[model samples]
Target: MRLGPVLHREGAFGGAGKRLGLGWDVAGTVDATGVATAWGVGDEVVALDHGMVKPLGTHAEYVVVDAGAVAVAPRATAAAHAAHAATLPLNGLTAAQALDLLDLAPGASLLVTGAAGAVGGYAVQLAAHRGLAVTALARAGDAELVRSLGARHLVTDLAEVPGGAVSGGGVDAVLDAAVLGEPALAWVRDGGAYAGVVPQSGPDPVRGIRVAAVEVAADGARLAELVRLVDEGVLTLRVAETYALDDAAKAHARLAAGGVRGRLVLVPGAGS
Candidate 1:
């Protein structure tokens, strides 16, 4: 999600970006019974906000997640199996929200950039499930991955696409998960909509299109819907690679390499 350019000058603090940087969304285990009275110890959770008061994170073992931010992990989803799902909730929610802004009804066409990444994964699936024709654009070797998510069309290069999409007809909306600054805006269909994890420089719809950034928030009800998809086998989590928590630096390197193809998770010690 696009973070606000927080400005702290003198004794005054102000947030830049209309609705950016709501907070962080994280996941971990409930180490205590305090924050969320409804949550309990041993419940695998995903949460939003800061750990200090709002939402505890999953950056470590035995994290103190806020109860309001917690959700029981899908049955059989071992906490140690992957961090993909742990990191998925926030990004997935962001993409779902952005797609909804397009207001395209079922059977409409939608385009997605960076289909190989975490948030991009949910974009493809949700759009498809809503009966929209999904066209996924990603790096080479990512075609098959996005295809499994219900994308009808796929492309390796944006240059190969015409009219803002691979199908040559363009799509009703463009979900630009891979923000590359200003030049990336060219992918949106003329008079359509553009959405990204980063806020667009132009707030208004360009060429009669709508443009906006996504900020993920806490929503148990939405999380349940996503989990239901996983339970029913409509959605699948992909772990590109795993690393020990101590090797988080290495994990970051792998993620920056750009061909990892899925979520890179950190595993705690003792074979967790």
Candidate 2:
């Protein structure tokens, strides 16, 4: 909510994978791994920061992940779905950390800006599961979507949210997932906790309320939990469109257009 993307260059579990400006979330079968590990030659796995031998990504056919960072893929979710789930870890972890900072109990008040976004959607469901009064602030089209994720209150615009209606003089916690600067800051009620993914735009949390920029980490355990939700049919993966790996330029263009809703998956096996 307060910041924009935070870029980092950190190595994953294996000494094999190094940060080379690669994508984080990844899914694939281990082509091969080292000795004394549960993952074998053909075991399918998901890993956070699992880069293929150093600069490669999930967009490729093969990737190498450290044994510790991976877990078995859910049988019910498709490969594409599992691949998409790989992307959810960072955003999901942001939601988890933000909640920890808020320190609110069940039935507390929570608001997520950019509720229709990748991470916002996760935050909404997580807050709802915690039994909070979830409110989603997003474009008018997203109201129904957010509501389905357990947001009881949907505000198409900030001016529309009830003033001082949430606990502690406003929503108990604010997760800013949209435009980082003023839009997100203005939405958080005074005295309520605020968290942001973009450190560039929002006020850092100082007062009793905590404010933070979001940077998601890879956690196979957490990813598995999200996987469980999808398997139970409680969570759904929405892909607006997919592009072949070679058509990556067009995919970038499409994402730039902002016309695409849901995730844009890149199918490596698409027609070459």
Candidate 3:
């Protein structure tokens, strides 16, 4: 089985008082079935065990998830790998759901902060695929990367993004994947919308700008669509490193050090 750990800030997991297993994304072959369902033993699958404080998480050698939360894994291809597929469920779903909250139409202008990051990267590609004009805000070095991901405009510095530029006034919407908070909200025009990755933690609505945060949920059907995109080469998955289950702490430390450009995966029984 393959797993990916999400290292979130304090209270991101609801301030759980007890120790909890640490994983959200999992990809592996089904080992058994609880009932007569579409899935069977030896079937390749992926799932999002959606929760913040579960006693056990997908990091284990085995996991039990609602069948509805599981989907057939992406077919292996030159562009897709099991490790890369393991990074999809959580980040891909989060980006797609956040964009749904924006509800922007084709040709609408959108700015995505931290465009080089996982959720932001997917948001860039998906927004562009939907025909939105995407301007990515990322580090200067990532300009080409974000542009390659379908960002039409690139701004290395927040100061370079002028207010009231898109749609004759700020961009139509902002996807604050970088969690820039109030500063990012200021880029939205009046009556525009803002969607954030952190639930209920976005800046308050101002100037008639509608604001909401995405609380990611598991939707197997939706995940299956994303898998199709990956197979079609419309989406890209990046893996920064892999660690064995026993080296989870080291993975956490690597994450804390920052500069990670992709997801960190954990392979059970594999060497660090």
Q: Mind sharing the TM-score for model 3?
A: 0.93
> For residues 1-272, what per-residue lDDT tens digits would candidate 3 score against the true structure?
00124434343546458667678899888898987688999888888999877778777888899999998888862223567778899999999999999999999999999899888899999999999999999988888899999999999866677564343377889998888888888888889999988877789888889999998999999999998988888898889998888898888788777667888888787876
Top model number, TM-score = 3
RMSD of 3: 3.5
Each model's lDDT comes to 0.64, 0.64, 0.84
Better candidate by lDDT, 1 or 3: 3
**Cα lDDT for residue 147, candidate 3:** 91
Give one digit per residue, the lDDT tens place, for model 1 in 1-272.
Answer: 23221111111123333322222444556667864297777667665453122222354655543455556565546665536556567666777788877778898777787777777888898888889888888866777778989999888877665565322346677777765434445656667677766543434455666777765566776776776777777777777777777775676556655555667666777342
Those runs of model 2 whose alpha carbons end farther than 4 Å from true positions after fitting are: 1-20, 50-54, 80-87, 164-168, 199-201
Ranking by lDDT: 3, 2, 1
Top candidate by lDDT: 3
Worst 10 residues of 2 by lDDT: 1-10
**lDDT, candidate 3, at 246:** 86
